[model samples]
Target: MTMNALTASAAALFFNHDGEVLIVNPTYKDHWNLPGGAVDIEQGENPYDAAVREVREELGITPPIGRLLVHAWLTVPGRGAQVLYVFDGGVLDHDTQAAITLQASELSEYRFCPPHGMEDGLIPPHLAGVWQQALIAHAEDRITYVPVRL
Candidate 1:
């Protein structure tokens, strides 16, 4: 029997008092995304830990990461399959927001956007839908599963 390997990633969803979600513009990608990266599964890193680590590496702050919000199973056509975990990063106070130090090599900027504005920044467009669902799941204190194909 043969085994198939699927990639995994974890992201942290942060928001402001105004209910705006935080999104980052990556230097390598044309569209914006949440703070996160691929899970280091080969190194024994889990989704939760990857979310925490990615946040620290990207934002330069160790904010409290809360409950899981969404688990997306995505198929990227020729790129194979991937599982994405989105976790609640809680609200970022002004002080914490001011302390952000982006990894210039990987990120260009970060901004807080209203839920309705996510579609304007996210790539593939469907990501905005995933994030919107995540926001809903966050509010309801539940988790959601989204399947996306591209």
Candidate 2:
């Protein structure tokens, strides 16, 4: 057994001027997600770099990423354990927001959602719960740890 066998992912939390968090609608999933993806360890990318890469690829903007906001772990049915990292992307300005260009093939749309009750159930509970906690941690100026159970 190799000690390095693990799956990891990185995500970012970007807020608009109205304090709404940015969420993306992936064409492959019914739920909206943060601008992030699995860490390309094979390509020598760390969690932080992966988050940056994902943001650039998915949103076509290169906003500066900040410290870690949320760290979580989830049990995958068949893929073993997965570690997830969420970074504080800070607030996007009008010019940065205007530069967003979604990857047409991967993402269908994007929106800035209120941190409270997400309108129309667009976000799943697992994500919503974690997101809410992340918001709380941000407000308190600290990092948050979340455990996801299936």
Candidate 3:
């Protein structure tokens, strides 16, 4: 029997009082992404821990991470399969918002983007849909699953 390798990544959905989602521009990639990164499965890191760790590493904050919002199955032609988790980072209060410091090497900038502006903020454009679903799942106090191909 043959086994296929699958990787996973975790992200968080942070919002402001104005209902804008937080997004970051990565220095290593052209597209803007949420404040999370690949799950270090090799190092025994789970998705949840990875989310928390990534947020701290990327944004320099340790805000309480809430429940899972979305679980997405993604298939990339060359990269194989990946599972993505989006967790509710909750709304950032003024104090937390003011403390954000982007990782100089990993991120170029971070911004709060309103829902209508996500299409322009996210790369591939379709990612905006996943983020929107995450917002809906958060608001409804539920979880969602989405399939994506890249």
Candidate 4:
């Protein structure tokens, strides 16, 4: 890939039955984002495997993977350009589970919250308004299953 070509990455938006958003507070950054990470090209890794692995690693819950919701260009300051691939995650038996806690080294917290609870004031400045937009896109039926790029 060219230097300017943003590396592709995958993320899981693990939504509860009530539609609550699962946000991960990461150890690497002050801002919380969905569970996901870079695609390990060295292992010949693809985006779907990376997404599932990230969710399992961060939350310790591995639900049946679901559809694609949104795809966009996400750039973390100083982390370089990244093409973000977000998928809709499905869960079962919500009440039986304990809240997923952040892994100490890479995560600080994880929680299910009202979609509106994610806002400018509380959200990381870089990702401030994204959750709302994602919800809006979902409500408007703009979010749909996207085939992973080959």
Candidate 5:
């Protein structure tokens, strides 16, 4: 049996003191996304490193990434088979939130969105589901492995 090769991506979940999650509006994509990008394995960058790098590149912040939150295996249409690593960005204080500066070429704007209405606010149905699972895992203080059809 031939096994399909899998690509990897990493994202970080940042929640404000009010519990609103941070989402970014990228200039290249119509939908909003979590702060992250694909792992730069070619440059010897691991998933965790990718997460940290993406945050700094996209948001211009160097907040410490917390524990691993979720591991999602998805067969994203067009993107193909992949594994996604989500890390906890922890709660962002007012001072940290004030420090964010968006990369104009990549991102347009960012917002702290209340968790309750994420499905209506976030783009791509799969992300909403994954975010929901991630939220639960964060609250439970455990890592969740998600295998879902997207």
Candidate 6:
């Protein structure tokens, strides 16, 4: 059997004070990216848990899961499809000033980004819309309460 090239995944759009963003620089491709991954369609898998797991795996720290940030559909050049689950989280604690048990294979660096400085940062262009949506959700007060899709 073969798996579809397109896939659904969850990502975190963490934020800090003064309109800054939390980002992880992937060690795999040496590119900065949001923290997230594909869903595990198991017996009792939770999206929030998945998000927390991803943060721990990638950043060597725990991010306080605050609320549902927003949703995005990404389109990569070669990847067939990209449906992303974005969440708003807060940085609880860590020594970003130095290094933790960094996921050397997946992430090399992590940083808190000021809103204005992100223009020159190396994030996927496809995630621009995602960032916009996250901001909107945050302002509207709906970010912390995403409704279930039934």
Number of the top TM-score candidate? 1
Which runs in model 1 stand beyond 4 Å of their true positions? 1-5
Q: Over the stretch 30-137, how does candidate 5's per-residue lDDT look in tens digits?
A: 688899989987899999999999999988999999989999988755556888999999999999899999999999899988886678956667777888888999
List, residue by residue over 87-140, the lDDT tens digit for candidate 2. 999999999999999999899999998887464588766667777777887788
Note the Cα lDDT for every prediction shown: 0.90, 0.87, 0.89, 0.67, 0.88, 0.63
User: lDDT: which candidate is best?
Assistant: 1
**Any idea what lDDT model 4 has?**
0.67
Note the clash tally of each candidate.
0, 0, 0, 1, 0, 1
Per-residue lDDT of model 4, residues 1-150, tens digit only: 544556877887666778777787778776778788888877988888889888778777777777666766655454456666677675435552474645677888777777777773545654544455556656665663332222
Model 5 ranges off by over 4 Å: 1-5, 77-79
Stretches off by above 4 angstroms in model 3 are 1-4
TM-score against truth, every candidate: 0.93, 0.91, 0.92, 0.75, 0.91, 0.72
Candidate 4 off by > 4 Å: 1-5, 75-80, 99-101, 128-130, 140-150
Greater TM-score among 2 and 6 belongs to 2
- Model 2 spans > 4 angstroms off: 1-5, 77-79
Clashing pairs in 2: none
Sort by TM-score, best first: what order? Answer: 1, 3, 5, 2, 4, 6
Tens-digit lDDT track of model 1 for 37-125: 99999999999999999999999999999999999998776567889999999999999999999999899999998888887647448
RMSD of 1: 2.7
- As a TM-score, model 1 comes out at 0.93
* Runs of candidate 6 exceeding 4 Å displacement: 1-5, 42-44, 75-80, 91-101, 143-150
- Summarize candidate 6's per-residue lDDT along 72-142 as a digit string, tens digits: 55444454555567777754343542433567787777777875455564775555556666767866867
Better of 1 and 5 by TM-score: 1
Residue 102 accuracy (lDDT) in model 6: 64
Ranking by lDDT: 1, 3, 5, 2, 4, 6
Model 1 clashing-pair count: 0
